[model samples]
Each structure stands twice: as C-alpha cells, then as structure tokens.
Target: MADGAPAAAATDETALRRDLAAAYRLIALEGMDDGIYTHISARLPEGPDGQKRFLLNPFGLRFDEVTASSLVTVDESGAVIDDPHGAGVNAAGFTIHSAVHMARHDAACVLHTHTVAGVAVSSVEEGLLPLNQWSAQFHGQLAYHDYEGIALDLGERERLIADLGAKNVMILRNHGMLTCGRSVAEAVKLTLNLERSCQAQIGALGMGLTPRPLSDEIAAHTAAQYQKGYDRIEVDGRPDPEWAALLRRLETAAPGYDA
Candidate 1:
C-alpha cells in the first residue's frame, strides 16, 4: 500500500483535471460561452504556506477546450503564480474576477458570460422581468451596473463592487451578465438559470404578444426558494454533494478538464 501512494496521488490529480475540463465542455454545450470572452474561476485549496489563490482559464482558450491543468493559478494582484500553458493572462479577466473575489468572500467561484439573449436583455431599459418561473427566481436578487467599456480598468473595481452590493447575480448594463456562488457548481448553475431566463424572455417578446407577468407574491416566493437553495451550503460552508457528482459526470464526458 505504501508503494501505491504515488499512484493514488496521480489518480487524484487526473480526476481533478478531468472534472474541470468537463465543466468547460458542459458550459459550451449549454450555449453560455461567448467565443473566448467569458471566464470561470475557482479558488484553489489553501496551500502549504497558508496562502489562498485562484485557478482561472487561460486568456485565449475556448471554453470547450479548457482543462484543469490549463487553468492558471494567480494571486490577488492577478499575477500568475503557476501556468503551464505559458499563455499570458488577460488583464480584464483579472480585473473582474479579482474585484469580486476580494470584495465578496462568499463568491468562491465566479462565472461571467456574454450570450446573445443575455446581452440583449442587458441592453433593455427595463432589465430582467418577472415573466415566468426562471425570471421569478431572480426577482429581488439581481443587481445592475452601467457599462463603462471593456473591464480593463482596475479603477472600475470599486464601482463594480459597489453596484454588485450583496447580490449574487449582476447584469452589466449594455454589456453582459455575471453570477457568483460559493462554489463552482453553484456559480455555473446560476449562470445557466440566468441564461435560460433571458432566452425564454427574448423568445416570449419576439412573439409580439403581451406576455403575462407573475404576481409579486408568487415571484417573491420563487425567489425566496431559489435563495434558500444557494444559501443551504454557501452560508454554512458545507460542500455540495451534487456539485461533486457533477464533476464526476464531467469526468466521464470530457476526460481532460483537470489535465
């Protein structure tokens, strides 16, 4: 058994790599990825030195092709501490993720996307509407921030954090949508729900018929339920078993994510 320890460690590393790779593939399959623009990041486990860092996708890689090994570890300053691919990290990616992570400790995993429906809804003056169950889930939980060009300015972090406030989901007005969660699974799920809501809303609007809006009471109730689901673990610091299962599923589907 002693001789097998190294092999076991290697196996564990491979599993993590495959799981992360699968996440990227799943994101692409859901149509939430926008070329090479969006990013998803998770904080690394505490290191030997008791330092906490994060893992992010390389700057130019497509979401579908991102693997766990391809993820670059960076400090709070956005400086890459470990990157095997040698692909320089994007400054804007660092600006956005760093600000949110620093300001909100609850946000262990951050997912940002620029889908067609998401960008379209962001451009609308009314913002997200409580037209159905999906939108209703975000009734009182969504925040909006005005656009200020590409997110390359570190100075914008203050305003971004200010607008985000305590909300988990944010619409970057005229830009895109962002979701943060206590873990990568929750963040990914939030983004998926947000995208689905936007797609459904846009489809409803294009029909040219007056869409029915949910009653305030119903909407509030639905939003409460959704919050409860996220809060069940986020606030309690408990690991989500469902998220672990998801990683395993991804491993089966795309075996190189963590590589």
Candidate 2:
C-alpha cells in the first residue's frame, strides 16, 4: 500500500502536468502566446492538509518547449517547491494567478495572454462589444480590470481580485486578457472564444460603420442557453467532444508535451 501511494501521486501529478503543458502548446499553435512571457498555471489536487500547490512554466522556456517534467511546482506564495533547475517564477504570473487562486476556490487553472487582437480590444475605450455570437457568450459575465503598470506591485493583487469578482473571464484594460476555470480545458476554451470575440469586434470596427449591439435581454437569453446546453457534459471538470478533440490535435502537433 505504501508503494502504491507513491505511484498514485505520480500518476495524478503527471496527468495535471500533461494537461497544462498541452494547453501551452495549443496556445502557441493558435498564435495566442506572447513569446515566452504569457503564463498558464494549474493548481495541484489537494493533499490531506488541504494546502494548495501550483504548477507554473519555467521562466525561460518557450511555450513549445514546455513538457510534463519541465514544469516547476510552487506554493501559494510563488516560491519554487522542488525546482531542480533553479528556474524562477514570473512576477506577473505570480501576481495574477496567485491572487485568483487564493480568492476563487473554483479556479483550478488560470490562463493569461497578450495577443494583438486581445490587446487591441482591451485598448479600446468601449472594451468588448457584443457584435456576434461569440461576443454574446460573454455578455454580462466578463470582468474588466484597469492595468496597474507591470503588475509587479503587491498592492495590485487585491484590486485585480476585486475587479475579477465572480467572472471566469476578464479583459485587462490596455493590457490583455485572462480566464479561469475548474479545469484546463475550460480555461482554454474560454480563452479561445474570448480571442475570437475580440477578433470579430476588430473586423466589425474596420468596416468604419457603427456596429449594432445586441439587446441586453437577447444577450442574456443567449448566454443562458449556452450555459445550459452548449456547455453540457462538464462531468469531472472536463467537457466532452471539444476537449477530447483538442487533446487529439495536441497529440498530432506536439506529441511530446507529456514526455
């Protein structure tokens, strides 16, 4: 039983590491990454004491280079737990992810990005407008936080958490975007949809005509339908069909992420 316990722990850790690494690779494939700067973090399954530990990418590695073994483990304070390579955690990652994981117990994974489309939408005075189906999915659920410089200051953590509130997705004003979910699949899916919404709004604005906004009542109804049916099959924190297909895509493009 003692020997089996160690094996079980290793299996759980490997599964989470692979899921997180796959997220990074898929983000890179979708051109949503900001070189080696952006981060995706996952909280470890709780132990007997119930203290949480998180997994973060090594500071210097590109998203394509991330693998199950290359990930570094850290505590709630962002201190490396058993990092053999001496790779340090990113300050921005620590500040943003740590703040959310501490505040929102439901968030098991947090993804942050700075893509051209995302930042372009974020810079606009009117934030994300409901110009299409993708935009309507967010509707009233998306939060917004004003960029407070580089996010290195400890003081910004509280403000960021307050701005995020109970929403799963947020647009960092003049910065970029962020999303959290009960699983990596959920977080990645939200990021993909948010990015598409931002891209569509940009294209609509390019037409030089004032884009029509959806009525609040209509938007609310659409969001409710999506939450009830479109997001069905959220069993075990993993959505079927889409998430299964995404993992297959990752296998073909970046097969060694779990290695």
Candidate 3:
C-alpha cells in the first residue's frame, strides 16, 4: 500500500496517478513543456487531516521522463509532507501552484507551460487575438499577468491570483501560459487548446497577412460554446471518452504515472 492509502478505499488513487503521468507525457508530446520549466499539479482527495493537498512533478525531471511515483506531495503552504521517492520538487513550482490552490477551490488541477508560441503570444502587445476558432474560444476569458522575474517571490501569489480573477486561462505577459481545470484531464485539454491557438496565431501572423477578427458577438458566442462544450463533453457528460482512452494508452506506454 502507498503511504497515503486507507484501510477501505473507494476511489482508486492509482488511476489518478496514471492520469497525471499521462498528462505530463501528453504535454511533452505537444511541445508545451520547456525543458522542465512548467508544472502540473492535481489536488489530492481530502484526508483525515483536512489538508487535502496535491501531487506535482519533481523538479529537474523532463516532462516526458516523469513517472507516477516520481511526483511529490505537498501541502498548501508549499511544504512537502511526503518525499518517499526523494524526487525533489521546485520551490518556484510550489510557490505558484500552492498560491492558486489555496486561493481558488475550483482549481483542482493547475498547469503551467512555456512553449515558444505561448511565450511569443504572451509577449505580444495585443495578447491573444480572436482571429481563429481556437483563438476565439479564449476570447473575453483570458487573464494576463505581468512578468515578475522567475515567480520565486512569495508576495507574487496575491497579485497572480488577482490577475487570474475568475478566468480559466491566463497569459503571463512576457512569460508563458497557465490554465486551471476541475480535473487533470480538463486542465491538460485546456493547455493543449491554448498552445494550438497560440501556434495557429503565430503561424498566421508570420504569413504577413492581416487575419480577419471575429466580431464581438461571435467571439462571445464562441467562447461560451467552448466553455459549455468542455463542460458537456469533457466534464459532465463524458463526451470525451477518447481522453480516457488516451490515459490508458499512456499507462501502457509509461506505466508508473499514477504511482
């Protein structure tokens, strides 16, 4: 039994571990991770202690190289409560994730990535543009935070939260991107969409062509469609069984993600 296992468990912790691990690999495949720069974390189930913490990737491990047992558990205060595998986690990662987790209850899983497109879009003067379907989905829903040098300062948490507001997607100006979801799958999906959106935008921009922008009404409608679409398909109605299948595939390919 794992260190956090209970005598009679209903939920399978191993499944969660696998899901998280699969997410890491998927992010790597999508080119969303930047050489161990980003982090993904899932909130653990509530325990007797009421801490109800999370598990995050170990520091220095490349996204593709991360395994389930390699994750480290920590409390909201950024302190490691369990380090059985001795997989060191980054203090900066903890600082960002713990702040969001502590401030927002809906943020069950927080994902951050530093891809070329994401960083490029973040640094753009206008931020994300609603020129494409992928970009339009984030219209009126994206938050922006100014870069504050490496995210190591504890004081940045409050401002980060303030900038995030109620949005699910955030662009760290001159930095990268952040997305929060009720589950690891949803978070991963959001990040994937965001990355693709940025990539598409950048590709379009490079052509030296002025792209057509969606009207405010259309952008709003599209954004609502995405929010409701994800809720109905990915979140509530099991509309995305493929994501579950992908998780299984990940287990076969990289078996120890959920450990």
Candidates in order: C-alpha RMSD to true structure: 3.8, 2.1, 3.1
| TM-score of structure candidate 3 | 0.90
Ranking by lDDT: 2, 3, 1
Q: Considering summed lDDT, which 10 consecutive residues are worst modelled in model 1?
A: 12-21
Q: Total clashes, candidate 3?
A: 4
48-114 per-residue lDDT for model 3 (tens digits): 7687678887778898888777777778775787765686677676788888888888888899988
**For candidate 1, lDDT tens digit of each residue in 145-207?**
999989988889999999999999999999999988876667777888899899999999999
- With a 3 Å backbone cut-off (N, CA, C), the pairs that clash in candidate 3 are 17-258, 18-258, 68-256, 68-257
- The true-versus-predicted C-alpha distance at residue 118 of model 3, in Å, is 0.3
**Cα deviation in Å at residue 105, candidate 1?**
0.8
Instruction: Report the lDDT of model 3 for residue 127.
Output: 94
Best by lDDT: 2
lDDT of 2 by residue, 11-79 (tens): 888888988998999999999998877899999976557867899999988898888888888888888
Off by over 4 Å in 2: 1-6, 47-50, 84-86, 235-239
Residue 55 displacement in candidate 2 (angstroms): 0.4
